[model samples]
Target: MVIPKMAQMVRCRIGYFTLKCSNRVVPRVFLPLKYQRLCFHTSWLLNVRGKEVLMPSLSPTMEAGTIVKWLKKEGEKIEPGDAIADIQTDKAVITMEYDDEGILAKIIIQEGAKDIKVGQLIALTVEPDEDWKSVELPSSTSIPSAASVSVSSESTESATPPPGQQNLAMPALSPTMTSGTIVKWLKKEGDEIEPGDAIADIQTDKAVMTFEIDDEGVLAKIISSEGSQVEVGQLIAIIVEKGMDWKNIVLPTTTAPVKSSAPAPSVSKPAATAAPAGLKPPSSGQVYGLAVKRLLEEYGLSSGQIKGTGRVNRLLKSDVLSYIQTNNVQKVKLEAVSPKTTKADAASRISAAAGKPSSYEDIPVSNIRAVIAKRLGESKSTIPHSYSTIDVKLDKLIDIRKKLKVENIKVSVNDFITKAVAHALLECPDINTLYQNGQIIRIPRVDISIAVATPTGLITPIVFDTVSKSLPEISETIKELAYKAKEGKLKPQEFQGGTFTISNLGMFGIKEFSAIINPPQTAILAVGSGREELDSSISPITRMTVTLSYDRRAISEDMAADFLAVLRAMLEEPTFLAVKRARNFMNQVE
Candidate 1:
């Protein structure tokens, strides 16, 4: 889409006078003659031969990536297709590789840098004996088109800058930073600002940090409030009055409406705010203080005409009814109202019966919470679910976990249990099948979903290709994916396409409970706390009680029992599962 470069006119209705709009732009020089040559400097370098790197797309759908790390030190010669750095896209961590021949002489951009837009210059490398740093760099203005400039003067006849250059917005520190609250302005309307001078203390989602000026020019106007939610990419301020030595900064003409010296009387729109005749207008208090006020406004009724029978002379529906009854405007029966209106009236009556005023709480639902709600609601309503519980000895699994911890695996006992269930899913595919369209869809791939508790609610992000992956790989992937899920940043693919799910409450110290199956998929494995107990021989024993919830339509009782039995055995003897994983990996590579 071609965005328009329209000039903005700032006008306000002062008292009783209506101001006329005018076409004007801020007067400021765009670029110096020295900076103008930056375009020609880089024009020749574009055709220069360089190494082309085809990095692995982190997300299955990512087309490009931003280099997060450069593991290979620059100026170090490397072989073909060597893993240099880690590139992170919208979804996952991918390996960055390049054709190995030239020495990495210069790193144009460093780590933790974004804006690696497709085909953008990320780094510079030199051919053997070639000087890469000798290449001329382009000025920031050389890369952009022209833009309109806003000139604020006491008189209206100030020269306006030519239109077309769009302003590049300020960079945000993080995604959650909605608005940066500007603390203080360091420069005035006509002072030059360098590339790295503290312009303002921008309070972000985390801590307040100093926002630096990009180029040297006079500081124009601050556009944002000290404390307000600013959009991700927005011009917070402007720089004007350029000099020969410094490049000019063109300001965008279209800025948000500021609190002008004049305040326009906001007359409510006729379509939305027109009230009935002979009724006194709404109070000049708040626009919407109560539900009665809004309801009256919605139905075109005024506040004063309706006799308030509610507490503290507040208006209510009964008062509106009484007022209509007292005046013989029109006679109507309740049943004459449409069904939709009747239902609304019924809901209102029920609400009134319950309490005096409407009370509600605002809850912020994360991406994880939204997914959990959608999945569980679908599961409870659609799946024909049945549950079965079995006690398994945790002695072997616990021992395996301890041994792995010593080997630097750093996985919890719960993670091991999840792996065991994944193994069982591969052995008994019938238990992993889903009932859909009058047939059992037995999935060949095992993508085990583990329930994670986020700030909002429970969510399950799946471990991709779990059956084919080893224990350590599964554990690491699960840890990374779970952390992402908890942070409410897991992509759609991570939360979807799961064959079976596991919800472990072991850390919560709960003994055992049946978990509801997540829908379409037939089964869910619920894990509880493992504890020490004396067996039939009065010996100390560590055991765990596991509950499997399966769709009766999809899985038979015998099948569920057999599936749990296999799962129990795997957990009881983790060595078998480890050996099986090794074999599977070897087979895949072969």
Candidate 2:
């Protein structure tokens, strides 16, 4: 497929694969002729000549990217985790890091090279022993054309850069983001913005992301106002080169509509081939996945029915919902589940349920809240979530907590649950894994991410090395993390990266509820409140419900059940925690 407006020449080896749709070419490492499913990867395959620095996917939505600048020139020695170049992704200009020690043999794509497809041969790296100067570019044997590939729209075209003016179109801040709400404009009209200067905080489907200016310019015009939901690539602001007249400049018109502007009466065309009701396809290219194709078939939506808002017209899951709302299309499952409804109808239902006014208030979704929604939806959709629940007698645990309270060593029930989970994971290591790039990584340390509810949304702050910390230490750490999460004072390391996650709604009196598994991690434990009940002895016994949601690909049913059983044993018998801690301490002493 010919990728339009992409001046960069993408060269790939014979065994490599390249998937192109709507001017978006995504390079793959599959054997020739392999098709059906697509998954994103960061590294390129290696050949006898050397490794190709295939353009790394900087963001989840990025199928293609631009090489903003190469930090290491050709022939420069690169260590593992070296930032080689800055890549312009759909989200931001992220520095691309190399993971292996090598000599930068040849640079295929240079700085300012735009629309370079992800996984395409951007550069070739040679081992330190090899001659970097003699290394040549990878073979330009273009990936053989796919026989049955979905094509990008023929009517789609790129907007040429007008003179020296920069059209600051709304970017896809997250993989699922089609349109973003301008939360606040950091750089106003007549303000000068340098490259990487924060321009505005954009409320994407995933989060409120700060959009940074990629080029130096004066804010000539701000088209989309604050709180306006602008679709990806829709002009929100205009930037002209440093000394341009910001006050008198006229705004340029584009095909993309300002979505959050005044709601006008929209009409769907009778012609099946006509464009989507009021949406514009975004970016320069697109990537269609298997799930999206299946959804299209399920919804009976043609390409023309819904405009994509992903990397260069890449269709997103949210786009399907947008189409359903736009056309008032009746869904197959919802017919039996509920009546067909529009936004107004849904709002009225909510109001009636809450005993509120007929007109409900529209709460602007913050970036953080969007993150939770997108993650929950994507986790439920992409991952085959399997569940295993265990009901553990909490009499022993409750007695221990009460006894500790008398000694001034008070610990919450969640602390005990968290500690018990750590012990259980250490025993059944198989369940403590992460599914990434189609690989199951069994993490050694037990870093548990505790889901904490804050004003913005539920944020998980990780408690690293939970297995090594004492119960008091664990309680202290959790309290600190929860406080930090609520205050928005969590550092990157404090919140990011974990092997397991625990979400407790026990405090809210929720008896039982399954939580969506966090990505990368294999499983999450949802803890419910403990309740007193008779357990065959005509005596009151406290029992707590805990459910484990796991990725079927990484964890089996047996694995999940065994993990829960171990967890139940540890929680039901409080001595197990002390014994496990002692054993660990003894091992360390040895």
Candidate 3:
């Protein structure tokens, strides 16, 4: 805790001080001045706070975040690059680092706080000249604004989702995922699950994928039922370690974990002899658990259809689930759902935003789609984009594909194109780079982000180390990645980063078109439909058109042209790849 008391030179360089905590992230609350984030680097975000430190936008899609825990205590000395706290963003718990010399004076948002808006004051810091104890919330902050009041009101809708209660929050399976739906819970409440066991099938913005447990525990409670949509970082279930008294676990509440005001009063446990009620039920009449009630309503079933298995006719969630499974029941119509959430409510909200009843024609923009639109719109507007086109002769590549198909090594032309791009990148390393924070970084390995369009929006899943993979391997990898992308099952690692991007509209019959560059990456290659043309010898030649979109600041036109030239030659003479694969195989045999 070093505190220098020099008022004259008390430099406030805290924009970079991050408390090195378990969860730290350079949030995106940085000001997007002049379409800047679309340029490169979202970490060093500087927002319009003037001089006040505010809640950071932890991720690109994160509008608000929960304060998971503070790593530094109030009055603690903070150094540059010191992590101060762990913040629960839209994705996960990321550490927040500060880079200024200051003392953490006060934490405006306490631990266990949720829905802390971006730009909201989370803490107060003071330079060496100031007394840490005397620091207070500034007058100009939005704490008194109507937006802040509305945000404060929303918290009363329900208790803050309990953290450290071993509650399983919705994990961000993919980096871009904001929310997910529980497709199914593999294990019911009271069932013990091991670290590797498939606990739940979560349907993310990307796909329905298994969420495996990472700790040995008994799933004591399932908060979100099947088909229940929840935002990422929102709790869905509760787990307790083996031998723990999970049965006595207090139901989550606002007052369970009290703060500086008073010690939390112990919540008296429900009686074991009589019927035990779970989370507040939807209604008073004979309802079971909240999820159980939702399932019952979803299937339009009455209590008479299923028998309660718990003590004193208390219906366990498993009982309702079992009944639905046994009967193969279908969900009731949406209109049959609670009338409180009616079309009129939705229309009024839409009308307020549009100044007219626009609900009839408007389709709600999903979070994933909104992110895509924002990033893409900014990329085109800010970057100094340059484009170059080339026609690659693919006769030999097509012949190689046919030969491989006969040998049961089926592959696509796109696979060969991807392989050629990888090899071309190897020879033209100048073009195999990314532009970040005004610096161009050359990546050693080729990680190709293949653009795959899903029903929701476009996603790019990476084929890492693409240069080292065989054509068949690349084909299979792309196929699997595409499938996962379409199903919304792509993991963060599969789609997070890449050295270059490739978008193919060849199959869509587009003769030629340019693609927008995926920011931070140097360039993107757009492949168009293949066509037949007469050669100089009056012989037919099959050629495919490819347009390269690159950041002119990072890659020169000459470099882009050289890369395309190498790619064209490699495809025209496809034996280089085949020979390379054969040599590698022979070396293994030896």
| Predicted structure with the largest TM-score when compared to the true one | 2
Mind giving the per-residue lDDT tens digits that candidate 2 earns over 434-507?
A: 78778887878898999998888887888899999888889899999888777666654466568899999999
Assess candidate 2 and give its lDDT.
Answer: 0.69
Instruction: Tell me the deviation in Å of residue 31 in model 2.
Output: 34
List of clashing residue pairs for candidate 2: 22-152, 206-371, 207-367, 208-367, 282-313, 283-312, 284-312, 285-312
Candidates 1 and 3 compared: the better one by lDDT is 3
lDDT of 1: 0.58
Backbone collision count in every prediction?
Answer: 9, 8, 34
Q: Give the per-residue lDDT digits (tens) of candidate 1, residues 162-263.
A: 332224244444322333445556665556677777777554433345666545666655555565434334455655545432234444443442222221
Worst 10 residues of 1 by lDDT: 144-153
Q: Once superposed on the true structure, which residue ranges of model 1 sit more than 4 Å away at CA? A: 1-371, 436-439, 580-590
lDDT of 3 by residue, 1-590 (tens): 11233112111223223322244552323333443322221122222111256889876456777676688998788899999998877545789999898878777776545667888888888775456665545555554231222111111224543443475666656544556778788998889888789988886654567887756989888777887666555567788878876675656553111111222114333222221122222342443544456666655666655677554455655566566555555555565455467777777787988877555565866556777888889999989999999998888777766666665778898998899899999999998887766788888889899999888888889999998899889999999999998877776557767889999999999999999988878799999988999999999999899999999999889999999899889888877675544443322221
* TM-score, one value per model: 0.43, 0.57, 0.55
